[model samples]
Target: MTVQPNIQGQAQANPVSEIWYTRCPVPTTSGIAQHFRWIHQEFERHGIKVESIRAAADQAVRNSHYSHTQPASFREGGNVPPIWTRANGQDTVVVGITWVDEEQLILVRPDSDIKTLADLKGRRFGVPKHDTKIVDIARGQDLRGLLTALDLAGLTPADVEFVNVAGGEFDLREQGERREGRRHGVVEALLAGTVDVIYAKGAVSAALVVKHGLHPIIDINANPDPFVRVNAGTPRPITVNRDLAVERPDIVARYLAILLKTAAWAKENPTAVVKAIAAETSSTEEIVRKGYGPELHLHFDVKLTEQYIAALRKQKDYLLEWGFLKEDFDFDGWILPGPLELARALAADDAIKITL
Candidate 1:
């Protein structure tokens, strides 16, 4: 079964408007409320206020990566968390906390000779916008796979096609029918017979698997270790809105602190968190226990370090090789850790008080 995000409450500060932190759900991030109960106790004594919002993966990443940025702008790719490097620029966070799962690469057409990933050389490929970024990240280690992607073609651009689809957001099927500016619309060309393959995201992935006769040549394994890839190449999240950050440093830091603590609590209390999350997720108590509940190995800390920064650098390189981001881009500059670090320092007084 597919897990859809829950759209919960908005923050309403009536009398004491000063809150300690706010939170957003990481895309596909399971079992948070389980830990929030404990995090809430830590803030209660501090008179800190807490808030939460939820949505699909990317939206969730954008909104909650910070406590202050709940309902954050969709355009701000800047606030991406380190935990999600494979997609949404989350390489800096510990691996396995949030991971990329593949549904396999399948041929949607009958005459398609793209039987194996290596057979697709010079053949056209399509990536619907829905889970484009994440999927790209999942395929990060497969650069050589691109050559095999082009229709088993020993042919160059003149020999085959790389179709462009203007897909819509969230829904992959509507990608072709959606407006040009809409995200994930990159698959229309495929639908119109202009391209050979359609690489799509979730809803689109499901649609392609059913209607278009999708076939799988790629193996999507859960990346167990994201940190190993981190090197000097990681892109630091940039705070381009200099004026906003400078003007509201305190609020920003406090918000980040809250999220850090939330991540920490979530990592520390897996069983409790998973049970609470079980209330929202599709997994059973037995599954949660068997999967992520302890035997699953989830982490509790959210601290960034040289190791994490390095991992991001490696991912940035992968993006560059794929022409997704600039090759010379300085990931270190993009990472805005001042607020998080400051919050961490101030958080010395922060105690873990909440219980299951």
Candidate 2:
């Protein structure tokens, strides 16, 4: 994507055609905007085509959802892949962050003797090892959750034996394919008596608990301390390739404006938000409500607030400490606030225009 020279006769860049976007199956403002078809409609009015990187036919193109290699693309999801990409020299800027805490649970079989976090001592903890070339997000998230749980009980990694359970690929498949491939290795290991404890989250995990009659030994979300609930998805970042943010900042701001509008719409429409999240996650509304809570809609607002920035910093440090990152970079320098500021202005003007 490129732009032409102005009236002053500056050098021209290549013409734009299409832009790419990808979001995880979670409650994100971008996902809500995509759910309502606002993102495509807004970009279409400007003669730009929008494509989903996850839906791309080529495996390499689809892998860009995790690698952030595709130029002029946007990604809103778990913090692991993006953090990994940034540390490994991917030039992307975090435009915004949304902190929507979901159900982070430590699970055991219903008939198991593990009833509390202290009971997890000496138990076999299941940690998924994804067979992917990119960053292993599942392992990072699972390990963080398990470590946090253990810390609460005054235990450490040495207190339990961690079992490496083989996990699926990192590719984000279609909704039907994702549903069909929902058999998690950790869950399988738990049920097969190979692991005594495992970590789970989101609506699908909630559904699995009901289906398998699994018992949750610890509810991380129920903890009053926000730090205790910090995981891969707590402070999700919305990122864009540097080329997009630097060369075509207008497009970046416009896209973020749509997300802002969607966030506002979500705040006043809890029922609709729940339905959209259910569709985005490929789960039932009941499960979405159960996993994310009824007020999940109110938490979709994206911002560059200090609170989320600190959370992201914590997550990044955790990843680096766990060896998920090659090296650490300037965390503060990776965030660009210009696009989000412009987006808020554009959204406010649009709101005023509608009012007028």
Q: lDDT for each of the candidates?
A: 0.38, 0.84
Tell how far residue 257 is off in model 1, in angstroms. Answer: 4.7
Off by over 4 Å in 1: 1-113, 128-160, 168-194, 200-213, 220-261, 264-303, 314-330, 336-356
- lDDT winner: 2
TM-score of each: 0.48, 0.93
Per-residue lDDT value at 167 in model 2:
72
Give the C-alpha miss distance for residue 86 in model 2, angstroms: 0.9
Q: Tens digits of per-residue lDDT for model 2 on 1-356?
A: 12223311221253567899999988788888888778888888778899998888998998988899987899999999999999999999999998888998899999999988889899999999988888899899889999999999999999999999987676685465333236567888989999999888877568878788989988899998887888999889999998777767677888888888887878889998899888888888888998899789899888999888988999999999999999999999999998888778778778311110
Error of 2 at 50 (Å): 0.7
Runs of candidate 2 with Cα error greater than 4 angstroms are 1-15, 177-183, 351-356
Let me know the TM-score candidate 2 reaches against the reference structure: 0.93
Tens digit of per-residue lDDT, candidate 1, span 252-331: 44444544555566666656555653443333454334323243224434445666456555655545666654334435
